[model samples]
Target: MSIFISKEAKDKAQGYWFGLLIPLLAGWGVSTFSMAALMSRDGPVSEMTYVDYFFITGWISGGLVVHPLCAWWVLLRAKIVGNAPCIKGAYMSIKLYILWIFFLLSMTIISFIWGE
Candidate 1:
């Protein structure tokens, strides 16, 4: 094994990390925080107004849509810069996206069960 890493390898690694981190943070992190904040409000879930419901739906659904797009964009940019291919980044993004979905679903269920 070579001790030194090539620039291309480094770029690809960076691209992969960015693809994972950006969406995970921007999409999952923000949505999770927002949802938690909304849920943690003074009133019960049943007391949430239309606007609150709209925002909750928007945040979760929007993250589902937008974050993957963000990942794709990042991967595309990396490819354009001759760093990495889209495959690995895309795979990572999809995995994270799935996990995010499950998390949101579980959170929603838990909130509904005990959020009185």
Candidate 2:
């Protein structure tokens, strides 16, 4: 009985971890690293404030939300129109990546204008 219960709990936990937690954490990590790298490109980040950190993080989080939805939409449209899934997904992903780069640039500009 204990073994059965343990297995059941593990199965449920796997679903939650894979379906939600993994993606959210991956998004957070990617956003954090990307923002930090981009910010450091202009100069050293020895004196950044909490507000600056949050601003960069928030912007990347917004991008993380937008990027996947937009990609899914593209993939859906491709499926409806009878295009190849692999090709469409790849193309859309690349486009979204470019947009992410653009987003980073815009964020950098905003940060500079807003000041340290």
Candidate 3:
């Protein structure tokens, strides 16, 4: 179980990691430049562009709920929910990602203009 499980797990991780890399990168880039980022003080996080995504979005929502829940949803769809549901869910997940980037932007702008 050890080696097999390890390899399979790595494969699965790589699959998801690469699968979402573009969306992640796009989201990060847009979020960094779009509006007043939620947690941005006066500069980019860590002076690294990608780190901005990893910190604000990752910590605020991704770490708290999005990443784990999406992983579980993906796994549940794959293992238990069957193909159709998985595909449908995956499509919606991508759409949700698009809308979410917009939502974050709107929220940041509103907060900046309106306060609190």
Candidate 4:
């Protein structure tokens, strides 16, 4: 019935969770919100399939958000290239995930409420 984890364990878990979840969600969320925006503004798109949306969002999210953070984490946190506090990096990633999720949910709600 123990539920508490050590600080380092929590950080590692957070880091792994960030690696597992955020990239996929960020890509999908960005794509979905962007598609919603495009449809709302342009009114019924004939071009662009789901695959296109996926690829574009994957590229944007991975390139902009995930990859850079991964690089930094691998390099600095894991000591692959630099020296830095590992837990801090993990905490930062968690914060980023929270902000991104909040923004994504907010945009999705707005789209649902106001989109046509």
Best by TM-score: 1
| Residue 22 C-alpha lDDT in model 1 | 77
Could you estimate the TM-score for every candidate? 0.60, 0.36, 0.32, 0.37
lDDT of 3: 0.54
Per-prediction backbone clash count: 0, 0, 0, 0
Q: What are the per-residue Cα lDDT tens digits for candidate 2 across 17-90?
A: 33333333445566676676566655457967776677676656645674465455555555675546333444
Q: What tens-digit string does per-residue lDDT give for candidate 1 at 1-116? A: 75438977766676667767776667776578667767777887777888787668857755887688777777777667665544477668878788878998999999999974
lDDT of each model, Cα atoms only?
A: 0.73, 0.57, 0.54, 0.57
Q: Model 4 residue 52 lDDT?
A: 56
TM-score-best of 2 and 3: 2
Q: What are the runs in model 3 whose C-alpha is more than 4 Å off?
A: 1-58, 61-82
Query: For model 3, how does the per-residue alpha-carbon lDDT over 22-109 read when each residue is reduced to its tens digit?
Result: 3344444544553355455576446656655555554455423554355445646555634443444455556667677689889999
In the range 1-116, model 4's lDDT, one tens digit per residue, is: 43547777666665656554554455456656655655555324567678656656755565356644653444354455332344445455556667766898899999999974
Worst 10 residues of 3 by lDDT: 18-27
lDDT at residue 43 of model 4 (Cα atoms): 28
* Among all candidates shown, the one with the greatest lDDT: 1
Against the true structure, candidate 2 reaches a TM-score of 0.36
Ranking by TM-score: 1, 4, 2, 3
